[model samples]
Target: MALISPFLPPGTINNVPQPVLTAKTLSLRPWTAGDTPVVFAAHKDPAIALWHRRRIEGLEESQAVIAQWAGQWEKESGASWAVCDGKGLVVGRAALSRINLFEGDGEVGYWTLPTARGRGIASQAVTALREWAFDAVGLKRLQLTHSTRNKASCRIAAKTGFAFEGIKRSALRHEDGWHDMHLHAAVSATPSG
Candidate 1:
């Protein structure tokens, strides 16, 4: 029942119930109903919501999201996580959304809680997700997109080895109308014999 990333190295594993990636003081664990509050708080920050599509309303909405995430988790088609701090408070959210097995690809999306910003949490979360996608799901390539103005997100991608692929004009519609986005990707390294 585990997913095999057809394009990854020979030994990649996928869809385990435990964490697939970890950082110095943080961990990325699968999203659950209890994590909704963290997700809600993270999205409350204007900086985090600027690039995303819709805004979260209140606890009720968060609950609904958690429900949907639970459903997705059951299927193994996509995955989401609540990034926890050393104290275990939900500090952010990260996801490997839009996975396509036939195409051997996945897209990463993430946001750090406002209070957790400027501490390298976003980068760590992104790195963890990329490792999972590459070594767990065995995706041949992983892609990320950030509105051109979202320099911090772009930097996160670059810091995690996602090479700048290109810029797509008017690719995303934010609250401020259409915006340009920079695409970045990390391709699997061919293993040596």
Candidate 2:
């Protein structure tokens, strides 16, 4: 039996610099150490803390997280971007995690700062990341999962053209308990428009 070839080559993502993607009102750029304060503050929001289930704790931890995000790019394991508004204020984060080059797939995750909520920042950031993942990085599919109780994330997934797949029963655990998650997905062949 012949072994299957990888859908994307190993250097597909790591060969070039992680790009800065721009939407009409938002820009998604690689996270930097200087953004540590923004990241630390964003995690202080109760909603973000509840949904993401991790805290920055302090400036030091935030800087470490940023370093980890950058290292992931070099390792070809993941990519993370800091979402900024038109005026260059860091407002959120968007990322592709669990990237599998052989499978041409990755998982999408994002969160917006409290002030940026209800402004579609997450949707725009996710849309930009989706395009980069599919077109530039050569990923064939992307999956996004959110806690069932996170109606906002569900809306973002739908608005960004990630079709509703189904629920993953008790898929993740948070401070409260295990939560059912809604899984949404998008494929490269399908236009997000």
Candidate 3:
């Protein structure tokens, strides 16, 4: 029998897996107090602010953000992993957000520290999250969206096997202005490989 069906329950997100998903170069795991410095540094990068449209103002806020990241799993609204390198230093982040359990859908997003770019870190982190979302968490559909201008993000989504869906005109409001977004998605019914 198939694992996924259209008749999933509304609180299916209660099953969000908290396992540490390991990739070839990354260990996607829960956030901790020690990750505060890395989180602060990543958000301080202007490019991250430009793309994500949110920035951590100070150490306190960074702590709060880590706390919030931890709380997301319990709330069943989202789950985020600290993308750490072999040394256990957080080089990036990956998250499944906007989770709708009744609909079995979630949105995936990620950001890498400036030092980690061009190393394929973001794509690997995303791939790990995608696998857990489908195979472990039982999420049926995962969507990824990025600004049309974000070429790197687009590439990461494609590299992770998220098929291009379409463009959402003025889909998001960033500090600069309203911007169009490119939508991509993956469904659990299909084999990623």
Candidate 4:
């Protein structure tokens, strides 16, 4: 009998594998419609809009963003988890976007609610997701790029063991102008079992 299931092309999965990750003080689960309100609240933080480069208008737009995230998971292109507190309030978000299964690569990003900042929650979520991406999703490498000005994100990346790779010049544009992106990456040292 074959140990592996029938192998399909990497990017062809119809739905993302929803996995719940637990940490010292966080619950990371797939985003759902019920999370729209909390997502809106957290996203309303001015820093979120500034760093993430998008404005969330209200619950309606928040719902749309969640739907879009689901759609991306279905297309095997992206996935996000709502980072929740012990009380189940969404305090942040962690996501792997621009997933190229064919290339065995993906990009990671994260943010925390204003209230959740300074708790080391982003780094914990990133650590959990990194293990999932490498061992469970069987991805070979994960990358993260943030505006050079976002020192907080750089700190989280370092804390989570994503080695500093380099920077992309003026690779992303924001409300102000183009910004350089600092790149960091984590590669699996062991071959996929």
Candidate of highest lDDT: 2
Residue pairs whose backbone atoms clash in candidate 1: 5-138
lDDT of 4 by residue, 1-193 (tens): 9666422255444444677988778889999999888888877788998889888889999999999988888888888999988998888999999887767788998999998899999999999989888877778889999999999999999999999999999999998899999999999876753
Comparing 1 and 3 on lDDT, the stronger one: 3
Candidate 3 residues lying further than 4 Å off, grouped into runs, are 1-7, 10-17, 190-193
Residue 26, candidate 1: C-alpha displacement in angstroms: 1.1
Per-residue alpha-carbon lDDT of candidate 2 for residues 40-118, written as tens digits (9 for 90 to 100): 9998899999999998799999999999999999989999999999899898999999999988899999998888799
Mind giving the per-residue lDDT tens digits that candidate 1 earns over 1-193? 7484344332233344636458778888777777767667766878877878767889889889878766665555567888888887778878877776656777888887777889999888888888877775667778999999999988899999999999999998999899999999988774512
lDDT of each: 0.78, 0.91, 0.88, 0.87
Q: Name every residue pair that clashes in candidate 3.
A: none
- Candidate number that wins on TM-score, 3 or 4: 3
Worst 10 residues of 3 by lDDT: 5-14
Query: On a 0 to 100 scale, what is the lDDT of residue 97 in model 4?
Result: 95
Q: Which parts of model 2 are misplaced by more than 4 Å?
A: 190-193
Model 3 root mean square deviation, Cα atoms: 3.9
A best-first ranking of the candidates according to their lDDT comes to 2, 3, 4, 1
Give the Cα-based TM-score of candidate 4 against the true structure: 0.90
Better of 2 and 4 by lDDT: 2
TM-score of structure candidate 3 = 0.91
Local distance difference test, candidate 1: 0.78
In candidate 1 the C-alpha lDDT for residue 74 amounts to: 57
